[model samples]
Target: MSEDLSSKLLGPIKLHLRVTWESQDSEIKEYIEEGIAYIDGICGESDYSVSGLPRILLKAYCRRAWSGNTSMFEEDYRRQLLRLQHENGVRRLRRKRNE
Candidate 1:
């Protein structure tokens, strides 16, 4: 696959599934698209980059959304999401103080 198309294949949506490229069927793609859409609905218009902590949390959230069951896992992800929000709030406050 060309670089452009390969990147396009995974653009905006990141999948943590173990399927090979050959086995990436429509069903799996639909799940990923749904997960990505779920995250985007909450996170707004970010590029969904892999660097930010919030983005990482969103990925975990997407994974949980795709899994369908396991509320325990969802709770854990929610806790982490809250922690990230708290940490970001602290950083914003510190920045404001120093300004």
Candidate 2:
């Protein structure tokens, strides 16, 4: 994408990540692309319009790219799993009262 176009598309994630409109840095671009791809994989399809918690996750993943850390990824992945399970109605079982 052109710098102009990419800049226009910058949302909270980009702002928080400090990705610039005139970003000629290859590393930033690569990490941002990786973040987008990661989100796509999680959703099981291609997605460009990102926002809300997913946007936060995308930023976190991109930051991880900069940090080169796996621990953050593991924690974030676990959080995503729990969120998915909750959304799917996989609730914890409640204990029964004794008679």
Candidate 3:
């Protein structure tokens, strides 16, 4: 898929990003969320996004945590072990110390 970003006055800025074609749709979203959690643990919430999170942060953090050497996330898409990925998911990931 190609997306053309443009301004009324400015012509365009074309950004080409990777696209993943997979059988597991819901699993992938959950996978990204798991990666985000791992990344958050590493980065400690600096300039996080307004919905309060961004997938790219997880990407970059994975770049850092895995020493830029592994694709652990894509290979290891997370699942709700113990019902963790609820609306309480973020809260649960945050409570590591409290636990």
Candidate 4:
């Protein structure tokens, strides 16, 4: 993710995690990066802007990570992950057809 995008997401992520202190800003930023990368790996690269399903999943991923439940995140979010994968596949097909 770009630095600008990361900065934009940090505040929302902190809010979601109920983090009122700035002490863990760097750690939360790392979680954001990891969440984005994990999502991209499973569903392909996406917009991951501050809204939409991708962002929702990213926030959930971070929550799970923070709570030490990262291992169960995939199982818990299996349906959404599959949906994202399908959507990304369709998008890739459309792009290829256009190309």
Candidate 5:
């Protein structure tokens, strides 16, 4: 949990890292390796990061991608709602039943 530890999701990819000298070398290696694999699957063959790219750039890219996805999803949902309302009478009154 140093300042160096960071995590980000870019597009469909995520990048994470944890650095320490706790002598838990196996755990450390697994953590970093898993990050790489996750990123690869999410990115799906994109060179999202340049060689020797700075951490800040990666973070910014991830934020943009994540937010963009969210925005798109919201828009799509709204459109679907509009379509449904149009198909059904949106202003139709609901009939109350007497018990």
Candidate 6:
């Protein structure tokens, strides 16, 4: 993610995490990066709007990571992950066809 996008996402993620201190900013930022990687790993590269499905999943992933329960994240979010994957696949197909 770009630095501008990361900074934009940080505040909402912090709010979702209920983090009222700057002490964990770096850690939270790391979580954001990890969440992006994890989601993209499943769904392929795509744009992430602040309030889109990808962003929602990213927040949940970060939450799980923050609480050290990442082991179950895939299982817990299996449906959402699949949906995102399908959506991305369709988008890619459409882009290829258009080209």
- Highest lDDT: give the candidate number: 4
**How would the candidate models be sorted by lDDT, starting from the highest?**
4, 6, 2, 1, 3, 5
TM-score for candidate 6: 0.92
Residue-level lDDT tens digits of model 5 in 1-99: 221232222211343323234454444333433434443333322232443222332333344443443234224344433443443332232222321
For model 2, how does the per-residue alpha-carbon lDDT over 1-97 read when each residue is reduced to its tens digit? 3454234335544566675664535566666667666665554332235455555666677678767873568465777744644443322222123
- Order of quality (TM-score): 6, 4, 2, 1, 3, 5
- RMSD per model, one decimal: 6.2, 9.2, 12.6, 1.2, 17.0, 1.1
- Model 1 Cα lDDT, one tens digit per residue, 1-99: 133432443533344544456444554455445544654444333334355755565455545655664356435666655665566567777879999
Winner on TM-score between 1 and 5 is: 1
Per-residue C-alpha lDDT of model 6 across residues 38-96, encoded as one tens digit per residue: 88998887576547789889899989989988888889999999999998899999999
Report the lDDT tens digits of candidate 4 across residue range 34-71: 99999999999887774888999999999988897799
Candidate 4: regions farther than 4 A off: none
Per-residue CA lDDT of model 3 for 1-99, tens digit only, reads: 011111110111011112244343343334344545555454443322322233344444334343444465433433422222342456657787588
Model 4 RMSD to the real structure? 1.2
Per-model TM-score on C-alpha atoms: 0.45, 0.53, 0.30, 0.92, 0.28, 0.92
Alpha-carbon deviation at 47 in model 6, angstroms:
2.2
Q: Say which prediction, candidate 3 or candidate 5, comes out ahead on TM-score.
A: 3
Over the full model, what C-alpha lDDT does candidate 3 score relative to the true structure? 0.36
Task: Assess candidate 4 and give its lDDT.
Answer: 0.90
